[model samples]
Target: MHDEGEPGDPDNKSVNSDPEVQQTLEVVFEEGDIRRRKSSLVPSTAPRPDHRRRKTQCFVHTLLEKHDGVASEDLNASYEGLAQERRVDKDPHSHAEQSQHSRLLTKKQISDMAFGIRELSKKLAQIKIMLHVRNIFILAKAHDETLIKHTRETTDWLLTKDESYRVYVEQTLEKNRLFDADGLLEKNPNYRGRLRFWTNELAAEKPQNFDIVLALGGDGTVLYASWLFQRIVPPVLAFSLGSLGFLTKFDYEQYPQTLSRAFTEGITVSLRLRFEATIMRSQDRENASRDLVEELIGEESEDHHTHRPDGTHNILNEVVVDRGPNPTMSSIELFGDDEHFTTVQADGVCISTPTGSTAYNLAAGGSLCHPDNPVILVTAICAHTLSFRPIILPDTIVLRAGVPYDARTSSWASFDGRERVELNPGDYVTISASRFPFPSVLPLDRKSKDWIDSISRTLHWNGRERQKSFKEWGS
Candidate 1:
């Protein structure tokens, strides 16, 4: 006969069955209440304290201690131990330990826990951090449809700050369909309402009121938005929705969950190296007359040069001076941190951050940089001379390029890909690390190398032949 006895039966065979089990399962019936009894699982020699039952949803664990009716001395001892004996070890992730209980755990265990808790944590953290970085903002470019598409896919209350986006969303909802590059998604109840799109400029509007910002687009979107912020940039998450993803490591598919944690939950933060460039105009005595002269030659240099005259601000990418669509030779002047390391030239010049090195710098033949290092990559766009090779420099040095009257539009300056003031005859462009940098957000699983790996996968940058046996691959 299988008797489903209540927890404590007057005559139970399982409780006092084994001699060892009987010793461990001591039952102290409440003096006044027989139905309610404290589990006496602790041995007299054991140091186990009484633990009160909490919300069962917190854990499926069975606490091994006295249930209910805690002893004053045991409670005091447990609290004292928690306060005195617990201390975090000094390490990279010590910040993670500050608000958590100190326990002797392995690296693998900590990583597993972080991975499990990450999704919800970001949502919880975002609200507090956004307030802390109130002046921070999010920017989107017109071209970054993918990032814009996904930003609305997985977030809540994102519309609270972006009203323009909300209007667009309502319009889209009224239309009840989508017009993607691939064609429209079918109209149906499932597709009736979907993701909303927003740009990064929303952050720049009231720059002093927000604490965090995001540039939802490809490298170009991020680059342009970053410029608008100038030196007052907030931490940015480069949400990439493009095929050629070098700067943005985040995936659009997981944006909702990820964005919530990052903006609301407070899971992770990252800092990205940025390069700043200054576009200097010609200081020739006949500058105005030259402008008139060039006008007579049917060459208008209004967009190429600024009216303010102090030179453009610092750039985050290389300071380039090269033939724009016109195949011509350019003599670009170079400078070093000190004069001894100076005097180098080629077709043009590129000064990039460890981050930008992977962009135009890579295309123009420069070294890839580790994001953490504060170094610049200066490479020639295309050199006619054998003496020119890309050089790495401390961000301290200021590099310059001047176009002679004969050179014409054979020289230009670009920052991150946001076309800065182009160089023309009599125009000298100066390049240096900007005082400002782009603060980025990194998921726990990502790093600079991860970016390179992601680019490789998305663009098929470098597809290698299968080194492993074919039996392990296609099958």
Candidate 2:
């Protein structure tokens, strides 16, 4: 029998020459096959240590040294191929010798090796992700000089803090000279290539490309950021600089601390709900062969076919369908999950998300729901019937509202109070919960508490004068 210090043994001086190879072998032996098998193998039943196991490990190190530039995946594939070849080339006549050779690595050893390879692959992947520079997109209120100054300060701070971060602003801001790029570059020449402009067209195409979104101004600015990213919205950090600070909970004065925390230790996010609104138009009414019910039920024909508009909108607040410049009340047929539920004869109807419950829905006397709740609020505007009241529905349901063919006047629909479209007699609008929710970063001291604070501070909820004491009244 060869001694431990022999030329072919794994403990030989020549085998431990290269530090990298030695380190790799140590890791594999400690956590992979060798350590496991040593503890499992019994003295009387187990095969004794032999030259073949040492030779196999030496071959693995040789393979690693020879293919030093190869990828980890390819190296793993090579090892698997070698193991397969060993199984196929066994001698059938010498059963005892074949058994001993194969017993070097049991099924557990192979599984452990694969598991180690996967863990190494995961670490490599994480390192690769960390190498890329983070991209931040800024969305602020338009035409505000004070906010513009604050934005420039924030931009300068970011550039000075991290050379790897790339900052992008709206094209309109650059074109209007609100964000003077030339002046910025003159002051900080190193930030020349790092500062960039993002147009609406580019933003719509690659909404998910940004790592984070920073909103300066009030809730309007935050909503505008939500509108810019129709799908796959990045995490948004909004600073309170507007008239309303509901969505913009963080103070602009504490930007340095807030932003530093966001950069170093990530911020907690509240995934706010949004609505997807689609407009479905019916074919020409004059040439239609089908009745109003048939056309509304989706009976397709050359003249009565229903076609959806080119694009759908992702609304953060609410979608309102109301009488547009008409003196008479509008008649609307509402359907819930494709079933006709009720007819709403009112000035209009509003469908909003839980995040928008405090907006138009609250103004129309709808229930105030928590933003985290998975619900949608449907509120009627000045209904003709006295019994009509606001109702809340699950977010999973799809709601459709259309003007009847015999209605006196056409109705108008607006998404988040914008993109107003006239709904013809047969046209309908569908509203549903979007798969992509807006991820807003909360303040360091806030989570659900921020919402409650906003309601009390902004709206003065439950505010009333206390009754005078009996002694004071008598005096």
Candidate 3:
């Protein structure tokens, strides 16, 4: 038997030679894995004090003093429970370990993710390829109550028409929505907000986004819509509610098919030319005083005022420089491309685009030119010389008409039969082909054949008693 004080004894207490303490110290120092694990489910406690008591003497003693009833055996049981839970969490077959493995994606998962991305790209390409039809802005004559009523009737009829028409209108309403021109929304409550109203109140608003413009009045209404969109005027489907629907040839009764076809199959769009004219004072090299010019351009030119933001004016038909309140004929000097062309001593001058050939130009004895003709028609309104007739010039050139400073009186210039300005002595008006052109939708059934039909139907062109045949004349 070994003595109790033996130097190499296996049961020495003072020398601290216990195998459990030695094994624990070896695990702590050699493994170097003394980290605290956190868990919400388990109650936390201070670390074990067997090996750490010397290093953390103050902390262990303080805990022992505070919890006087806690025994060493109870603390050992808690530490063992925590260690078992941690070991299970790190086990390869445990639920927590399996969940960690699941987060790491495999090759098959990466391939499936790539395939999903490609399918999404293909679907987006198909969506981009589909044809898109948007909103239709409708314009009706404001002052005419009867015409406004008729327009509302047409809209209501469109909803209750054949299933095709109803579906088209509903889809259009859904995709892009419908809008009424300015004040028409107030008069008709049915359209309230479903069909929005746009006016000058929305300062910067324009009709660029609208796909098409539908006019429910006469040819004048169609012209008004053209003026509304000063830039690129969209295709217009004009319905004739006037005495003679010459320009507005589409019958309101047969609008279901025509409107649908315009929305789907599309129609032949007639590009009608327009002209922009600017009026400048003659004597003043710069510009005349606004008050002086406004006084000279009195209330007589009130009809010419438009809500256009820019001071410059655009005209679809013609500009007439006539002798206004002046007894004498207007002495006008015309220039082509800045070169003096001719001096016309006439009642007035009618500068018209081919689209306006049948307007004031026709009534003034000017030849009717096709709308497709790219020419400017200048006709004299009762000229002094019989030889000075109407002439057609290429649209590529700019024409400037001036009232001579030595003229008998000042002349008045009107645009599209409206917005008139007084041309004082030396005052001149410049005319050129506008960058924007009107896109007019032609009739599907008759197409552009309505031009000659309008001339014969409206003007009764060349209507006369049939000439006697040669056989009847006894030749």
Best by lDDT: 2
Model 2 ranges off by over 4 Å: 1-133, 175-178, 285-304, 466-475
Which candidate should be chosen as best, given TM-score against the real structure?
2
Residue-by-residue lDDT tens digits, candidate 2, 1-475: 0012211234311121223222111111112212335667677966766744233457556555534587654445455455433321112233523332211223333234334323432332222111122577888764788877787788888887898777887766675576677888889899987888888887777764566788999888888888888866766889899887889878889888887777665455566777877777765545645344444433432222344443478889999999988899889998764357788999999999888999899999899887877777999999999999899987656677888877889999998888898988877787776645676777645553888898999899888999887765553
Q: What lDDT, from 0 to 1, does candidate 1 have? A: 0.47
Tell me the lDDT of candidate 3. 0.58
User: TM-score of every model?
Assistant: 0.53, 0.68, 0.59
Q: Model 3 over residues 1-475: C-alpha lDDT tens digits?
A: 0112212223311111223222110001212223356654455575555754333458556556543576644444464334333211011123433332211222233223334323332332222111123344567765566755665556555433332221112122222213232343455445443444446322124444444567887778877776676654656778877776656868877777777675555455555677767675533333333322221223311222211111345678898999988999988888764246788899999999888898899989999987767778999999989988899997655676777656779999998887777888766776766645566767655653778888888889899999986755555
Model 2, position 184, has a per-residue lDDT of: 86
Two-way TM-score contest, 1 vs 2, winner: 2
Sort every candidate by lDDT, greatest first. 2, 3, 1
Scored against the true structure, residue 329 in model 3 reaches a CA lDDT of 93
In model 2, the clashing pairs are none
Q: How many clashes in each structure?
A: 41, 0, 3
Model 3, backbone clash pairs (residues 3+ apart or across chains), number: 3
In model 2, the Cα lDDT at residue 177 comes to 72
For residues 1-475, write the lDDT of model 1, one tens digit per residue.
0012211123311121223221111222222222323675556897665865554543224344345686533334454344333221112234433422112122333223333323222332232223222222445543345544553342223543332221122223223223241122242222222233333354334333334456566777667656666655545677776557666768766766666565444434444545544455554454544532232112442233321133345355555666655566665545331122333345567777777776788889888776666676878776877777788876544444556555444466655555645666755554554434455666644542576685577657668797875556665
